[model samples]
Target: MNNEKYTLITGASSGLGKEFAVQCAKMGRNIILIALPGGCTPSLAENLANTYNVDVRIFEFDLTDSQELKKQITLILERFEIDFLINNAGVGGTSLITETSMEKIDQIMQLNVRSTVLITHMLIPHLLQHERSYIMNISSMAAFSPIAYKTVYPASKAFISSFSLGLREELSGTGVSVSVVYPGPIMTNSNTAQRIISQGIKGKMGLLSTAEIASTAIIGTITKYPTIIPGFINKLNHFLMSILPMELKLKMISRAVKKELI
Candidate 1:
C-alpha cells in the first residue's frame, strides 16, 4: 500500500463536492476527484494543485455504471492510499411520481443509491489498510420526512443515512470512522439559489451555503462525529420534524412542496 494518504471525493466538479475538495486541499491533504465525463474537472484539478501545492488527480467517468466504476476504483486503489472516502455524488428531482420517466428514476437510484453503496463496498479493504480512515456520506434533510413531488429522492437519501449509520457501528472497533451529513437546501449554483430565493421566507429558514456545509463536514469527519448537521436552524428544523407523527410530517411537507410545484 502507498504510504501517502489521499481523500477520494466523488462529484468533485461542482457543488458541495467541489467545496469539499477545496477544503481538503486547504488542509494539505492529497486529493482524487471524480466527476462525470465532460465536466471541467481537469481545470479544477490544476487549480487545486497549484493553489494548495497538494497532489490532485481527476477522474471522469459515469459513476452509475457499476461494472466500470468497480473496475476504475480497483485500479485507483492499486496506485494510491485513500484514507478518506467522500460519497457526495447524487441527483435530486422534484416532480409527481407518475409524471417522472422511468429513465430519470433509474438514474437517481443508480447514481444516488447504487453507486454510493458500491464504491464504499469496493474501498473498505483499502480503507482498512490505514491506521486511521474516514468515510463521509452526504445525505439530505429530506430523508427525515416523506414529501410530495420528491418521492424517490428523499427515500434514496434515507437509505444513505441508514446505511452510513449501520456501517459506522459495524466498523466501530476498526480504525475507520463513518459519518453521515444531513444538509438542508444548499445554494450550490445560480439555479438552486434562484429556486430557494423564490420560496421567500420559507426557503431561507433551512438554506445553507455549500462552503459552510463542506467545512463542517470535514471538521466532523476528522473528529469522528457520527452525524453532522451543519446549521443550527437546520438542526432545529430536523428536531421539530422528528417529533411529529408520521402522517402529520407527511402532510406538512406535502403542503410546502405543493406550493413549489405550482
Candidate 2:
C-alpha cells in the first residue's frame, strides 16, 4: 500500500480555505486543493508549489454537483493517499426566508450541507488508509443559535457541527479524528473586513483573522481536538449559548442581527 499522505482542502481558492492551504504547506504536507472553476486556484497552487516546494495538485469544479464531485473524488483517491480532509467550502447570505428565493436556498444547502456530507462519506475509506488521519469541517458560530435574517445557513452549519462530533465518536480508536471548527467571523477579504467594520462592535466581538483561525484549526485537528472554537470571545459565546434556553438564545441573536441589518 502507498504510504504517501496528503491534505485535501475544499474551497482552497480563497479566504479561510486559502490560508489553511498555506499553513498546511508550511508544515511540509502535500496538498490536494479543490475549488470552483474560474478562480485564482491555478495561480495559488503554482505559488504554493514554488514557495513551499511541496507537491500541490489543483482541481477546479463545482462541488455542489454530486455526480461531478464523486468523479473528482475517484480521480483524487487514485493519485494521493489523503491524511486530512478539510471541508471548508461554503456559502451564506442574510435575508428573510420569505424574500429568499428557492434557488438561493437550494444552492446554500447543496454546497454547505450536501456536498460536505457527500465528500466526507466518500473520503472516509481513503482517509483510513493512512496510519493517522484527520477530518476538519468548517462550521460557524451561527450554528449555535438561529438568527432572524439567516435561517438555512445556520441550520446547515448546525448539521456540520453535529455530524463532525458524532463521526469523531464513531471513529474513536481507529486512528482517524474528526474535528469541527466553529469560527465566529473571519476577515476573509477586503469586502468582508469593511463589512465587519461597518457593523461596529457586534462584528468585532468574536472576529478573527483567516490566518489565526486556519493555524489554530490545523493544530487542533492534528492534536485530535473534537471541537475547535477559535478566539476566547467565541469560546465564551458558545458557552453562553450552550447554557441558555433555545428561545432566549434565538432572541438574543435576532436582536444582534437586527442591529447590523439596520
Candidate 3:
C-alpha cells in the first residue's frame, strides 16, 4: 500500500540486483532486499538505506536451498508487505556438454531455474494481496541462441524466458503483472564469465550498465509489458532467430560459440 511495503529484489548484493535496489530506493519504494549471505556488502546496503530514506530490510539466504528460501521469506513478511518480486539471483557455469560434469549442470539448474521458480511461487500470495504487483524475471539473450560450451546456462534461461511468458498469461487481469527481461551481455559478472567462454562469440560492444538494464526492466513492469528484450542489437538478434530454420539456427549458434571461446 505504500513505499515501505513494496519492491523485493533477490540477488540484491551486487551487479544488476544492486542497481535495481538503488533505483527502487530513488523511486521512494521501501525495498526488501534478499541476497546470498555474503553477497551484498554491508557498506552498499547501508548506503542505500541512507540515500533512499526508505525502510530497507536485508535478508540473506541460500536460494538454492528450499529450507533457507522459506525461512528468508518468513522473516521478510514479519516486517512488511511485499509488492514487487525480482527473481534475479543466478550463477555462471560454463563448459562443453560432454566435458561438463552432472554435478555442475545440476548446480546450474538448481540456482538458475528451480530456485527462481520456487521463490516466485512462494511469493504469489503476497503479490495477490496488493492492488497491483509485479514479478520480473531476469533472463539473458543467451536464451535466444544456443551456446554450445555453455549449454546448461542458456537452457536455464530459455526455461525462465518460457516460464515468465506463460506466467504473464496466467496472471493476466489478476492485477499482478509478470515481465521477463532478456538482457544481452550486461556489464556484470555474467559478462565476465562469457569472456572465459571463448573469442569470436565473446561478448563485444559496450555492455549495457546494470543500472540501465534495471531501470528498463522496472519501467517495463510498471507499463505492464509481458516480454522485454533490452538493447537494439538484442532485439535484432531475436528477430533474426525467430525466422531462421531450426537447423540453421543451431549451426549458427554453434559456430558463434566456437569462435567466441576458441
TM-score top scorer: 1
What is the per-residue lDDT of model 1 for residues 184-214, given as tens digits with 9 covering 90 to 100? 9988877667666766787789787889999
Candidate 2: stretches off by over 4 Å? 1-3
Q: What's the CA error at residue 110 for candidate 3, in Å?
A: 1.0
Query: How are the candidates ranked when ordered by lDDT, highest leading?
Result: 1, 2, 3
Which ten contiguous residues of candidate 1 have the minimum total lDDT?
253-262
The true-versus-predicted C-alpha distance at residue 38 of model 1, in Å, is: 1.4
Candidate 1 vs candidate 3, TM-score winner: 1
Candidate 2 displacement at residue 162 in angstroms: 0.8
Predicted model with the maximum lDDT: 1
Candidate 2 lDDT over residue span 1-262, tens digit each: 1125889999999999999999998888889999988999989988988898888999999988889999999999898789899999999877778989999999999999999999999999878877888999999998988778888989999999999999999999898999999998877777567656766797799888889999889999999999999999999988978999999989888776655454
Candidate 3, residues 68-179, lDDT tens digits: the string is: 8878777777667888889998876445678778777887898899889988998888889889999999998888867677888988999999999999898888989999
Which is superior by lDDT, 1 or 2? 1
Determine which window of 10 residues in candidate 3 has minimal summed lDDT: 197-206
TM per prediction? 0.97, 0.95, 0.91
Is candidate 1 or 2 superior in TM-score?
Answer: 1
Judge candidate 2 at residue 111 and give its lDDT.
98
Between which residue pairs do clashes occur in model 3? 3-30, 198-260, 198-261, 199-260, 199-261, 200-259, 200-260, 201-260
TM-score of 3: 0.91
- The TM-score of predicted model 2 comes to 0.95
